[model samples]
Target chain A: MQQGPDKRFLLLTASLLAALLLGIIVATGMGYMAIGAGDILKIIASRLGGGEALLTDLEPTIPYVVLEVRLPRILTAALVGAGLAMSGVVYQGILLNPLADPYTLGISSGAAFGASLALFANMTLFGHFSTPLFAFVGAILTLLVVMRLSTFNGQISAQTLILSGVIVGAILSAGISFLKYLADEQVAIIIFWLMGSFAASTWQGTGLVAAALLVGLLVSLFFSRDLNIMSLGRRSSDALGVETARVRVLLLLTASLVTAVCVAVTGIIGFIGLIVPHLMRYLVGPDNRRLLPVSTLAGALLLLLADTLTRAVLPVEVPIGVLTALIGGPFFCLIFRQKQKARSYE
Target chain B: MSEQELFAIDQLSFAYGLRPVLDNISLTITPGRFYGIVGPNGCGKTTFLDLLSGGRRPAGGTIRFLGRPLPAYPKRQLARQLALVPQEFDTGFGFTVEEIVLMGRHPHIDRFASPGPEDWRQVDLALERIGIGDLRHRLTGTLSGGQKQRAVVARALAQNTPVLLLDEATASLDIQYTLQIFNLARLLVEDEGRTVVAVVHDLNLAAAYCDQLFFLRDGEIHRSGAVAATMTAETIAEVFGVTCQVGWNDFSQARQLSYRYRSHGGITAAPSPAGLGGSDGA
Candidate 1:
């Protein structure tokens, strides 16, 4: 009898994930004028099955948009979503705070600064490779600074970590604004990049982001038991022979690495990381073994759906980040309300 | 079998930054003995337990277990021999009671290995031993304070370590649960012949259950010996600064220490009513 509900829940989760993926593919395919679901599937099948003539037979413009344009954007959305959610799980686990997200520790601001600097100076290094490399470096440097500042007298309190992150984030934001001031008439490009978009996404960029996110997620899953112990609080975890400080440092570095890669590839896509894990926790419970994987899949689906909406909602393409904020802000308020109700009873 | 010290702390000293929490503390715990540490709050009792458990390194002295330096032992190996039941834990996750208990077997588990049938059996037995078997499937967060303490003890029991260190594991528990945990610790000592060391705040509980007692005051050892010799009213007054009387309880087969009200100006008369079996008026 007990197994019945557990099995049903698992089945429901798997079906929901599959349905979401299919819905994103269909919605993205329907965005263009010439393409339909059937034609999109035929093109995808012909390309995947290595049938060149069958793929070429589809409308020239249709295949180009479906394969080259929409596909890369959808894929990038999925990668960024996964990266953000994985980092969220790691940060929340290590800090033992549910509100911890990748961006909460100033990683996004650091990435913004790096990207803006690249844009303002026309840095050839950031151009040759993806901007993510510079963003990754900037994010890591900021994380190191925040960690050093937070560790006063050889101890890191939760309050100190949060405060340091806020201060450093403000500093980095100011630096980005300075870069914008120095930027020429090309400042519009810098401004749009800061706002975040999927317009510049490519298959190569999507692939790199996906690989980095996959590595991060796999490593986190392997250490799920350690993460579980960490949620018990640091002192008790250390007493249990966990080497708490070492675990926290490793997790923070890994989460930052994932965040830098994602933010560099697709500007700051907000709320998926912050809200997806919170929702998944309420749905499937807070066991990291289940929580991490479920959140990754759910986040990917949410971002893909949101990106599809961005393309379909207006004749002109809306920035994916704007849509996420517009939708996520109200969702965030709902979560706060729920939390308030829960706190009242407690 | 001739001689083996399970734990030996020699001139161990530690401080938080530079505050000097523990100073020149030397003690030895042998196999199959129940040792109790009693001290006033902020007297470095918990810090001493933390040092012995390898959670903190002593600034001055050495700690040896099984004739090897404490730091030399690999973390997993040391965990196999010693298990610590902390004073309080929130356990803020969705782990079941059985799952929490089974974590004690982590040291014995190999990488990527799942718990075996024996591990599950041991966890079941531990829950049963702690008398919380019925709550096995319940989430740890939903349990009451007494139940949570029992679950933690169950986790330590499942560890199956030879030496157990409990740092006020019963502080927040009710009297019944407190006695229950003490009785369980006694059973481990008597039946399994395990060495148990507890940092306890209650003096009576220490006198009743501890085979040996160590009293700490201001980061220094005030007294140490068999319970009958070290738990006298004079020693209690000297260490705790309380006027108390000591007597034997025939029914419980243990010593009992009772404290009297303070006299004027915190001074008491000679042959005061603090003595056991004395009249209301001295």
Candidate 2:
């Protein structure tokens, strides 16, 4: 007797994701030293085949730009996007607040501070290892601090949580500023890092990001039912056989790890983490079984598209962070306005 | 009543910070009995419900379910036996009524397992039982207060537990809805032979429907017994700090209560026994 809405939301999300991926690949191929779709495929096929034939025919710079440079950057964007979006979904579910995003818990600022410290200290012992590790550590520490500060009598009130997050974020930002002040005269590196860029995107960065994203997304799916119950409120969830506090702590730790890894690789690329999950929620509803996977795919597509635009739309090359903030700012305002309208009706 | 005790609280005491909410209280509920817990606000009715439902651990003493300590039974096992319909819940996401009700199957379903036909059948039956079957496809957020309360009760009923605990299950509902829910509870007790415990504020409703009533005062059981014996005017006035007259109505075969307000330095007059005889005329 219970035949739900016959329309399948999954098919819609999948088709949209496929279209976005195709659009991104085509758009990225249209950069200054344009590679035709046929050549792009040929190069990819040749590389997969472990042959250097495609490289022999192409202009020396073309393969380097497409395969070595832009491909890793695009993959990095997608990985970071998926990770951030997964974190955003988990954070929002745990907080039971729609306004919650990855940054709301200070994870982003903490990672940024860690990266800044790495830059200032000139920690080149293990090359790229120091930055990501420090970022992950910093994010987890910030999460712990915020959790400890907000808790009162074993319950974390909404007001105290938000306040603690803001306070922690402010402190992390101050730390980042301190690092910037101590930075060498070569201020371009600091500025670029702060504004966020994909200039340093590499195979190693993409691999790290992909690993973190996959693990985080998988773990979150396992806890999807708990998250669904948590959205109902802590007391009800507890009554429903969910260990609310333990589940919440695990979710926060997992989300923070993902956010830290993403921020470490690509600074603070805003909006994808905040908006992708929200859009997915609006489209597919709040069933996390659908929400998490769809949000991950949508987040990947969005960042890839944004990265493509950043490369294709300008002559001097735009930082991805600038593009994301510019796009996300308007989208955030639009959503805020819609929420206000909805609230007014209530 | 069945000899099997569904829930037993032994010298249970709980406090919020410095103030004790439940103080050295002990009670036992048996199978197939309709138990009504009534008390003034801040008198520990809800706290006692919480203890029974495993929502709170008592600071002192112990709670046992089915001859075993509550902590010994795994959470899911305990949930399988006892279902709670909380007073209020806020759900931000808009789950359809059918979907929300189906969550009651959580304790029964295995991890990563999809709901089978049996689950859906239970959900449909629950919705039908609550008389909200037509509203199954509607979002829970759009439901009225009474409908929401019914939906929650439907969820609890869907759990298929032998025992049910409700905290003010009909507090915000209209008279019609309140009667409907109480009638459903009565059916569960009489027809299904399940143990139903509810904390109700309306004394008349409790007296009219419940087989037994438990009156709580200051976290302790002030009085408890058959409804007629426990719901006298003296106990009501003493527990609630309000003057009320308890009477019987033969037309409805129900006990009724009429409340009176007392002014300063005024002596409250006792209800006359002749007024009790008016039940025959009605």
Candidate 3:
């Protein structure tokens, strides 16, 4: 598949955006307190326009639950999914490895380790913000270390980078395990956070994630051409005037930072970063410019759908992270096998 | 030759870590000439090409491109002036042949800009020139080795730079593609007035195509000049450690290098020019 912005691509993009909006409206109707899609849209429109409530026939508590409570959680999950998917597209493109994701470079585990340590230490230095702050710092530092370890004679080899990520990730994971062993009372808290959930989501947290994602996606799209060149490997990119060192380091930091913020906020949401890019790539192609938007929408939809299924469809509510793994795992294999034979597509 | 020098390299040297790969090399490259650097493995031919194209920095001395210091130009500007057809790459992405060729337009297209109609025309011309226009829609990863090699060269051609570099670029191509690539290089040099410096593994092709030759051995230049002057059997033996007869074929009127078994330099024999005069047309 080659990257092109054709009519079909435009159609798919519009359809995916529409699907995401529909999914959100449908998702808000779940969780014991059912609400109609028309009423949900009216409530959202009334709040967004700062106007009078158009659906006064609906109970005010329904608006409160949808706007103040459920919307924050649902929107946060959607933004985190989009952010992680954007990071995945960047990671895979820059690293020149199809298997690369937010987790492949160990940024997530680094964030997890730092967050776990903060949980055990009962860090209140930044009040409610301390754990996420620690996680962000840990992820940035690990990215620098991984880049340093992979560089040889001013060149960063993909194989070396992957190896460095694995080794560093192993060490950080061990450190996390040791922190778990040391924690006596907060162990359950740490475990649940690691399992990932949006139950604690607030409007403020959703706003933070939304702002981060907006900036990150714009930055990713800005470097989309250079990322395309980078797929040819380092020397070819350089020869094409990509300034491989500068572009690689810039995109690496941008993607890794976005991934860090997502992991810090959500504990550890899996599969969105790994699976969304592939799914969108199969639909569109490998062109970062074309793939980014569709992947973002697809990711938001996938996670929102998974979150909805776990929140209401399942008899016993499971963590969103567990639900994604269960659903995305088989879906990935099926799509991968199916796409293998249809690749002459435009 | 325009009496204008494209590259004026003086005492240029480079090393990988503690080991020197190019040492005290000085050369002048004029515009519109096909220059070939040939040597045995580990003789650092590729390293020399790398330095000339500004892919690798020289450890010492100076290289002036078009009368300006090489490093003074930003990478993007330098790329517009020089392009490199690197050795066969392991493309890890699923970029199509057209997309891969389109990357050569990066030097012309701005970061925020897309490839316009003119740019697409150039890419199409490059694909056609490389004789792969029909396969433009094919994914590069699925191409045969020779097709991939041509696609890489086509990308360099698409760049439309003033100077082009090749690092054993045709070593993997079949004989037909190899000849086609050499012809393209010559046409680029003569008709388009573009300077080309290539590191070639095929000694015979290098002799026939290259206007000038540089022989490297032990991290130093053994000889440099017109192909006929430096491609002698004695120099080939001294540099490549192979005994070869160097002569011009009367049919094609192009110089040729032929290998023959020989004892050590203890016995010297005159080169026999037989069965090589007619146009073999390979």
Point to the candidate with the largest TM-score: 3
lDDT of 2 by residue, B1-282 (tens): 234777787899977666577777888888898999998766778878888888777889988887888878767788788889888776547677877788888887887998898887888888988899888888777777778778888888888888889888898788987888899889999999988899988888898889989898777788989988888988987777667678997865889887754674333543332211111000
Interface RMSD against the true structure, candidate 1 = 2.8
- Report the alpha-carbon TM-score of model 1 versus the true structure: 0.91
lDDT tens digits, residues B1-282, model 3? Answer: 234989999998877777677789999999889999987667677778778877778999999988888878788898898999887575556778888889899989977886888889889899989999988888876888878888999999899899999988887888888888889889988998988999888888888899999997767888999987888988986775566778988875788876654665633453332221111110
Error of 1 at B51 (Å): 1.7
> Which is superior by lDDT, 1 or 3?
3
Give the local distance difference test score of model 3.
0.83
Residue A136 in candidate 2, Cα distance off native in Å: 1.6
lDDT of 1 by residue, A127-171 (tens): 556366677778888999999999954656566787788899999
Candidate with more favorable, higher TM-score: 2 or 3: 3
> Per-candidate TM vs. native?
0.91, 0.91, 0.93
Per-prediction interface RMSD? 2.8, 2.3, 4.0
For every candidate, give the share of true A-B contacts it also has: 0.33, 0.40, 0.65
How well does candidate 3 match the true structure, expressed as C-alpha RMSD? Answer: 5.5
Better of 1 and 3 by DockQ: 3
Two-chain DockQ for each candidate model: 0.34, 0.37, 0.44
Q: List the candidate 2 regions with Cα displacement exceeding 4 Å.
A: A1-7, A153-159, A178-188, A339-346, B1-3, B262-282
As a TM-score, model 2 comes out at 0.91
